[model samples]
Target: MRLTGLPLILLAGALTIATVVATVRWWRRLPIRIAGLLVMEVLLVLEAGLIANRMARFYPSWQALGGTPEVAVVAATTAGRLDASIAAGEAIPWTPPGSGSWGLATTPLVVVPPDYLTCPDRRFPVVIVLTGVTPRPAEGVLSVVLAPTARTNAASLATVPAALSADFRVTDTYAVVAGPGPAQPGLHALRSFDEAVRELPPPLTAPHRLPS
Candidate 1:
């Protein structure tokens, strides 16, 4: 689910107001109100600190979050190219140049092709993991992405091998691109990529020609 910046900001504002109201309501009834407020403030501060830490740690990718919108290509590469697809919200197929076969990952993995001008020989499969806007206590969108495919129903772009191995069979080779919205957590996205790679089928033994 893609979440725009406006909704996130609004949600934050609402939460802040709710916290304030709750704090004020209990202030008159108990002496612990002071302690409660102090604790709440401390917790809020800590939460802010943690968010800051994550922002800094994920700066490279996070910076690309709301900036110039471009196609974020994530790809994977094996000795031989295998057919694959991404499932962020929908499945999109990708076939890298120069390979016998290719397969997509289980999650929404993108393919970053080698630049024809510079690194023409570079071909790698990539997975683009998107994060959601909603900041809640429960599991974040990133976490959901990284969660086991067997557990969640979010978008999943995976290779045929990975898909066949999965509880459900994927029917295409493409990247799953999700719109900007509330996501679980980015870590889940990474995890999904890793899982897809790990679960992909081993390379074929003989060369096979594509159907013309």
Candidate 2:
């Protein structure tokens, strides 16, 4: 099973429980804390091995981060939004300003405000979508989740559908190596989301860090 985010905390809690059970005597015999730790450590090592083995497989052959391949133009009906007030232009190719970068582009996703044209001044909601470890953005989020919801709801929404580099893939993938500085590639994935939002220009950019 994937051990990420909250699960790690849960593991710590489980280990704590095991530790308590070992320390706190029940009746006569000492709890198996030492033995439990040894077993748990062994299990942890095995788990690490299994995780490492699985994560090694995520280095997909396709380019990540920078460039995207050509795919059939999603029908205006089926594909993501073509042009919205939130978008800088009609789904411009997402190429960062600098040359030195990681990852290749995968899909043609658009990032737009919920109501850019209608509510130019109002700060609406922004959704920075990071498609799971897969190469392309999950169409379901853009098509199934957001589209239907956006049509019905008036909350100005900005979604990053498609257009993310494979570098952003974190789930079931390698760990984020937080280098000394924020410039690290591993950390760039999320910061890049902020950068993308900054590109929105004018009013749409205000909600870069949306409120709680």
Candidate 3:
């Protein structure tokens, strides 16, 4: 028979009742058996609690790793409008345009909003393009083949962040542009984003704690 949580709980309760009944009937007899059963019950309860804690933690991590791999594209007619509206804030943006094109000359196009595009006092959302595999160690430089794939994959897997936002503090207003790659380049981007979001330090409340 399949053992389920409810049945196991019932069985454990029954066993506890049986143990109590036996102790009441024979107050000082079979001390070894009674002690052993009590020890077993305590261990069972501890094990169940540990398992429950693990499940609670594991479900979120597993969900972030698993799901549909697709990119989400939010198109803006003009870069200025995108910069003024979406880019307004401390947040950043990243795109993978032309990264999927199959050509040595083809390179991902990156656009940064001009300071004049928006109020100088307002912090615009910075769109960072994570380049594919590249021999160069410089940031944003990706390998020619890998760059396109990554961009494409990013577009395909856009839904992941959308879905994850329901459970976690995912920024719904953010934008991602995925290009193409050998597999899906977006997967790496997603991984990188996940790591970044997870590693972010809690905001410092005291002005003295703020960096100079």
Best by TM-score: 3
Candidate 2 local lDDT, 1-212, one digit each (tens): 24333455457557756655655553244446566666666666645644454456342222522355555342211212323323322233344333112222343234333343444333322233333221222211111111222122112221221222221211111111111333322222333333333433333222233223
List per-prediction Cα lDDT, in the order shown: 0.35, 0.33, 0.37
- The superposed Cα distance between candidate 2 and the true structure at residue 123, in angstroms, equals 4.1
Candidate number that wins on lDDT, 1 or 2: 1
Per-candidate clashes, comma-separated: 58, 10, 29
Query: What is the C-alpha lDDT profile of model 1 across 1-212, one tens digit per residue?
Result: 11323444355456656666777888786765776677667667645644564456433344545575544443332222232332222222332232113222233322222221122222222233333221121110111122133222242322333433231212222222233343433323333334444433322222233434
Q: Please report the TM-score between candidate 1 and the true structure.
A: 0.20
lDDT of 2: 0.33
Query: Which residue segments of model 1 deviate by more than 4 Å?
Result: 1-4, 31-212
Query: Model 3, which residues run further than 4 Å from truth?
Result: 1-4, 30-37, 40-212
Residue 74 miss distance in model 2 (angstroms): 41
Which 10 consecutive positions of candidate 2 have the poorest summed lDDT? 169-178
Report model 2's TM-score to 2 decimal places: 0.21
| TM-score leaderboard ranking | 3, 2, 1
